[model samples]
Target: MTNHPHASSDAANALAALAAAPAAELEHILSEVCSSPAWAAAVAAARPWSDRQALLAANRAAMAGLTVADLNDAMAGHARIGKPKAGDATSEREQAGIQGVDTALLDELHEANAAYEAKFGHVFLICATGRTAATMLAALRERFPHDAATEAEIVRGELRKINDIRLGRLLGDTA
Candidate 1:
């Protein structure tokens, strides 16, 4: 994949550091990207990636093998769409669309979030990078009727998108 024109020297430095980091340390860093320990360890085991694309491919493969339990572990790290974790820049940035919106919209979104969790038995997850609050609520409502199997598959896809975006931020790829 072509690199972002704004890819900084910091990304290069970070990649080099990641390549040379101890296994435990590397996995720790990766766990922040996607909180599945298996995913982190698997990707870490494939270290010294030749480039961003290689690293991404490794992540994809690891993600493809995740069990339901692994997905649950990863989902634990995410906040609800309208309620980003306080003091977390990453969550704040990803859920920025919820900011400055109508309070009624936010309240309705929170109510919908509770209903979603009650029906699905997990937090509603989405790649909320640039989506508006209303948009997220609509999507959540749309997906609310999916059967368990379909929802699980959709969750995996959303996790993949979130992981890739976080990885892109980590490596300055703008992917």
Candidate 2:
């Protein structure tokens, strides 16, 4: 993937566009990546990224700085795993594994989602991009036993994975 000749230039162009965008516009764009205003603001303030790597590093740093409240803010933006938010292509695409799942499995997934949320006080989150419905459900159940602090760290890690994928898309880096 690093062998691609135009990758660097493309990333530089994307970074430049982000850097030059108006504050509101940049924040709005970033909100789709991670809903926490503080995260968006931190990344936005560190504009004029030198390269794709720099932007990615900034994203990691900003994510590490997120408070529990900020994590909640980011989590609020995601829909439940099986129930993708209307018009949210990202959620729909990521949760594609749940599509056409058996009725019994769907019902079980719904019930598990409710229970997970009840226990964790947030939606069941996973990097559903390439995972099956059963896989996500199993993860939800597995994580259910974890304490709040542990779960929060897991959520942060998942959120970082999601952020990296989204930012790659934003930069048109399919590879």
Candidate 3:
């Protein structure tokens, strides 16, 4: 990111490059990098990264404080169920991640998602990494009965957890 040998310049440039992106581009990048409320600020403040590890670490740290709204926005960038892209096949993780949802589970999740939206006026959000179809389906069923405020917070937490695992793999960096 930086031309000079100094770590400061590169870190600064990486962060600046991210910050200067147009709002939509920034949002897409943030969603691609990690979906969390703290995404914008963390990516925005990624200056002075010592390396890829530090950049990802800062992202994790910032995501620790993400609000529900942030998680939802990040999810908006994802391909919805029954709408898989060929590129999703490019990432084995995505394959494994998506494979966790079986047809039956997908059907139930769809119904649950619609019900969740009807009840809460938002998407039925989750961080689907490493989750099995039954487990995800159960989770959707379990969470479906919750009231709006409680469910909103739960979805946010799930998004954060999912984001952490995603970034950890993406950059080979852990928080």
Candidate 4:
């Protein structure tokens, strides 16, 4: 990705550039933020955000309105909770807590992930930033009983949290 002049700028300035960027460029940037094409397009079209908070609010709203198909599309971008691969530094860092656990724990996580995928028909999605591998496994197990509709809603919420974190990073807001 070419560093657009505003990519490293402050939140307000970056968002201002995002609003005015060419459609393809804006879509590319927003896709990195969230995988759902509809979500990205909606957010890009609703640009000119007043501040970081407004951008986050729009993200929340866009995510909240996602359909099950959109949610599934977005979830496809995530690695299974404890099994992040070498690619995608953002995912690796978000799931850093799971990086160096015992083999037994990693095996258990793999098994739980398989089970979760079997039950939900999608990878277990969560805001794994700051969460332990055990916690992620527990969450997968806990959510296993939810019906498909319920699980989809939970996934949407998790996706929203992820989008917020990624958006903050995009805008160079450490907090």
Candidate 5:
């Protein structure tokens, strides 16, 4: 994975700092990227990453190592898909494509989110960046019939995609 050509100098510096930060601070930073204490602690403990790719690979491995409870904890940090909260810049930006949608579409998304949560006991997680409201809603509908085990696996995959995107963003990748 190549770094974004327009990555800011500050992001590069932040990456370097992250590689050397103390365990507590490192975990704190990693938590901001994905909100699982276990994931944060594991990734942080494996630090002094040689580069962004190495860091990302370790993140993927750490995520894969999590138990169902840990995945649930990570999912708790995300807002419902298509319903970005005020002042949450990360969610707001990630769900930007769904902004300004009509009330009908938003209502459908709301119902779908509730149904998904009722079935899975967690928020519907997706990598919403660059996807339209309709697309997200369609994906939710498509996944509604998945068995519990299947849905759990799907959630894990989505979380991985989200973590990758967030890591890239943390490194100032504008793309």
Candidate 6:
């Protein structure tokens, strides 16, 4: 029962104990473990997990299963401020590699981001891993030109990516 352990011999036991938990308990455990609805819903559906890989596989499968409503619910927990918060815990954890920008730059990005959201009727969505702030800004600018249908699909994809990150974090839970 340490705070950190990776793929330990007891991992299967821990996972089974979680997977066997009742739905309310599952939701509660997973809620503490991960806050995203898409991730939580996916974990909840991953009952009877065979092992860590099975749990991860279920998490991925769940992302693929997300409905538009589910994606929006997942997105609800993230920052959609007129400006992005540099290193916002939720976004940083979910999109650490993908969404970080220099704190100094968020102020400048705010107006353009707001204008883009205003035109699109939804917040800009990016997978936010392995990219720079400037890169993300460029993506936002480019995506702004996309029509609603295209943007909707892109948002859905972004939500799925977030779900994946949350699931990995939760599945990497304490021993």
Arrange candidates by lDDT, descending. Answer: 1, 2, 5, 4, 6, 3
Model 2 misplacement above 4 A: 1-7
Candidate 1, residues 57-96, lDDT tens digits: the string is 8888888889999989999999999999999999999999
Error of 1 at 63 (Å): 1.1
- The model with the greater lDDT, 1 or 3, is 1
Instruction: Give per-model TM-scores.
Output: 0.91, 0.93, 0.62, 0.91, 0.91, 0.69
lDDT tens string, model 4, 43-86?
88677788778888889889988888888889988888777867
The residue-by-residue lDDT of candidate 2 on 119-164, one tens digit each, is 8889988888888999998898899899999999999889888888
User: Candidate 3: what lDDT?
Assistant: 0.60
Q: What is the C-alpha lDDT profile of model 6 across 1-175, one tens digit per residue?
A: 3445555645566676777788888887666534556667776876787776777677667656767666666555556533345756655544443345566666656766798868976567776655566766778888888887777778767655655555455555421
Name the runs in model 3 displaced over 4 angstroms. 1-29, 35-38, 49-57, 64-68, 81-86, 89-92, 95-103, 173-175
Error of 2 at 98 (Å): 0.9
- Return the lDDT, model 5, position 161: 87
lDDT of each: 0.88, 0.88, 0.60, 0.85, 0.85, 0.64
Error of 4 at 174 (Å): 3.2
lDDT of 3 by residue, 48-142 (tens): 55555666676666665666677666666555433344576423344254464567767876787677678876666666655555665677778
lDDT score for candidate 4 against the true structure? 0.85
What local lDDT does model 5 show for residue 140?
96
Q: Write the per-residue lDDT of candidate 5 for residues 16-98, one digit (tens) a residue.
A: 88787777777777888888898888788777777777888888898888889999889988998878978999989989978
Each candidate: RMSD: 2.4, 1.8, 6.5, 4.1, 2.3, 4.6
